[model samples]
Target: MTATPPLSAQVAVVTGAARGVGAALARNLARRGAKVALVGLEPEELKAVAAQCGPDATAWEADVTDVEALTGLAERIKAHYGRIDTVVANAGIALGGPLLDSDHRAFSRVIEVNLLGSVATARAFLPALAESRGYLLQIASLAALTPAPLMSAYCASKSGVEAFAHAIRAEVAHQGVKVGVGYLSWTDTDMVRGADEDAVLKQMRSRLPWPANKTYPLEPAVDRLAAGIARRSAHVYAQAWLRGMQPVRWVLPSLIAAVGSRDVARLAPRLAATAASRLRPVGAGGAADTAARSDRSDRD
Candidate 1:
């Protein structure tokens, strides 16, 4: 394998840095000598992550959906670091259930955070990235390429961000800004565990194809992400198999639909009943009880 460039004295801003993939990524970046700024809503958790990341790492609490707050954070980090070298718009949320059974408010909120929030992060950090000829990494999901039932909002948001990243790449490449989109299968993250807590959802996911059904360990994925960022990769896949899936993406949706149709048909009623009470948006904290709660309106 080729060696990654050193990140000593470079500045990296990672949203959703309190836990899960975000937390791990920040630490990994720090190990490579990047001064990381952890941004999320969970103050205590963020502080802990920063502490582990070392003295140069700082915690900045802000909701990804809050455009003004994110913009201010960018300015603050730039002021403190002198220049920003990389940005990882990794903050995202997941909501699952049958469309009819899902809360419209929660559905909108997912899009607001996972999709628009990524856009805001990119917009907020673009100037600094451009100035330094830096890299921007958007964390998407396998859901973006392979749509799943009972996860309408997540599929939509991840799909949107993937497209957003592609479009943004075209716009920013001329300015020497490199853009990358990350695709992950089910990993051992709080978000996956939260979704699995619903028995019906768990059953449905278990029926998925081989590797997709497996929840891979978190460390390997984060390690690859760190390496990808160091190399300014155009696309990053947490699992090696996912790389092959990209070129054949056009046929994946149909294949998944065909295979998943039976599972959805069997679990539809249970999904509706269980999703309303059990499905919580994955956020700052690893699990539902501690995850950030959402308001009824996206305007909030």
Candidate 2:
């Protein structure tokens, strides 16, 4: 690792920075004096965020699923900025449904972007991060901690992210590179907005507090993400109450087997009716889901 500095003019790279919490985090980091790289799939979207972040920000449009594309983006950022002090692997997608009827392509996409994409971002930036004794934040979810029924692919992707972050942290800790994992509850982001319209999901979001709401907006998570980058933390739970689930996550396996059996029996009809008529991902990413609900057969 390179010599550590007390944090000024540091370069921070944020994946998925084009929108939602990722975009918010990029703005927050820029405010805190870090030169930021805004990475996303859409240049126009990235430009919107970059415009707000001011001159210290650069935009990189690359699909996280494409290794060569993300690698090239990382190289370009490194070449321009000379170092990457913080890398936030924040790009993600939610693919949820019963494993039996889930869209296979969507499941694959989620794994590629969330699980593989997080790893690729870290791999591409690790050299510079190690050079700066920097930090890497893998933005995971509570799904990683506790797999809710009907979210098999999304759950698997995030669970993979958590384990990946933990192992990478262990590998790089001695070298002064700090790795972190972020767990957030359903925010008012596109992903959750998409999920919220569902009756079961609506019920789930209605169950959170401490932040006092399941949908606590993106600001708190964005603020904490910047703080974690500055302090070089190992993990940041956006909804602090997520910690309480740790004890239960251990029991999650048997709990699901026992509870899922009963809950699905009750939840099935509600999940089906709402999911059939109105289940759709919302916001800027709505293009993909516009025709997605027409037929499950069409997605495959």
Candidate 3:
């Protein structure tokens, strides 16, 4: 492992810093004495987080899906902070429902924000990160490694981000810009609560295999994320068990499929009647069919 430089002297950028994991991460970095640029879509909420982060942190409202806006935001942060030492592409959204009952657009929007947004974040910040030989961390999820019934879009997006992060790591390592991917299980975040609001979804999750059904506290995960940034780790797992799943991931999908097959068969009849539209994630956008979905409860 490379020795960490003084965080007090580094400037870090965290996307989706309005709430949940992103907000927590921004605060954690600030507590460690790093200057933070809080990036996200919620202005008032972002400002509130920035306040908690102190004078060294500032919030900018920019959607991660817009490349130009993100690029401009990066330049502005660079101009203000003088240099960038870390970039956490932590913005993501989620949609919940059986794919058969899900609106095609809701699923597409999740991919746009979670996967493509991470890609945009990486591209926008790469120039500054490369200049400083800094670290780029992508906030993926356990969804990336494990598949679940009501999270097809979410799983796909996270899985894409994981693969993209690895590919980017290889492309940029020579430039001294380290890339890291963070994997988290179900944490105490608004997204999980939003999904749980649907009784069917909640019950479905409860039936998952041991450890997989566990919901961890958020702060510990944030602490691990902060440490990962400091260490410039290749991969970050918020919970210990998450690390073990990495190696057995190949077997996991099959195991989960075997267990869920019965549930799927049982739920198939009820899924069509589950009012999936009402089950849309809290604070999601779009028309009745497709609104901006916030699976993570944080905007990017």
Candidate 4:
């Protein structure tokens, strides 16, 4: 009999696989011998990521926010792979600006994609995961732990996913479907780079304390995520220091409020002077999400 690969004969589904953490994680899992299903709105980018994931990988274009599309995609993925041993709900977008000045639609879109989209992903794939006794990893962020100024939408969405994943973990435990929440600090992704383009936003991030302000390399961080997937960890921290923050999480909001308020006050004028258009979603992935929504609206 042929010996199985190190990570097992697993089939993994990754949403937002077109770029950043999602794309990197898909490639890492594929390297470990998992057949990957790459899902996202950018068909061509998803195709490119799928190619990097090798022959056993395939790309599917679908919006994570659309329950019908995701449910159908889940069915097709299960049919194509025969089983889905892992599902990574990593699709998300970020919009950075003061809440008062932010575009209402852009702010809401962040919540829809990052939080509700995660819910939709879980709803669609839980059945397949339960059947395989598989793992579901929800990609949250440092924003979830420490609320920051100018990132209300992103923070709220990440925090929501973290809570949502925790609640479902209890509900689905008997089915043997393990749910894990993955957290990342600032990483060298398109989203981060996009946010850095605006001097005021960049300055606000830089003002953050110590290691939390640093932008980490993507590969090593993703390698840790792959390890977490293998172990089915309850909480996976891309940066080591993040795990330490958990014990003190309850105090973070107060701390951030004290510190971030000063920074926001100092930056407020500059932020207000910045063009309204520049306050929109932060990266190419975010741009694609906006365009796709526009297209959908046009169709409607």
- Worst lDDT run of 10 residues, candidate 4, spans 291-300
- Order of the predicted models by TM-score, top scorer first: 4, 3, 1, 2
Q: List TM-score per model, in order.
A: 0.93, 0.86, 0.93, 0.94
True lDDT of residue 118, candidate 2: 79
**Candidate closer to the true structure by lDDT (higher is better), 1 or 4:** 4
Q: What tens digits encode model 3's per-residue C-alpha lDDT throughout 36-128?
A: 998887788889999999988998989888899889999999999899999998877776777767667667877888889888899899999
Deviating ranges (above 4 Å) for candidate 4 = 1-6, 284-288, 293-300
Q: Which tens-of-lDDT digit does each residue in 80-158 have in candidate 4?
A: 9899989998887787788889888888887888889899999999999988888999888898888888888989988
Comparing 2 and 3 on TM-score, the stronger one: 3
For each of the candidates, give the backbone clash count: 0, 1, 6, 0
lDDT of 2 by residue, 1-300 (tens): 455454467888887776678788888888888888988776788888888987978988776667777677778898898888888888776655566555566567667767887788877888788777888888887778876766677788889989999999989988788888888876666556655545675664454333434466678867876777777777787777877887778887676667666667766777676554433322224334432121001000
Off by over 4 Å in 1: 1-5, 278-280, 284-300
Question: In order, what lDDT does every prediction score?
Answer: 0.80, 0.70, 0.81, 0.82
Which scores higher on TM-score, 1 or 3?
3
- Considering lDDT, which of the candidate structures 2 and 3 is the better prediction for this target? 3
Best by lDDT: 4
Ten-residue segment with the worst summed lDDT in candidate 2? 291-300
lDDT: which is higher, 3 or 4?
4
What ordering of candidates by lDDT runs from best to worst?
A: 4, 3, 1, 2
Candidate 3 residue-wise lDDT at 294: 28
Query: How displaced is residue 297 in candidate 2, in Å?
Result: 23
Error of 1 at 280 (Å): 4.4
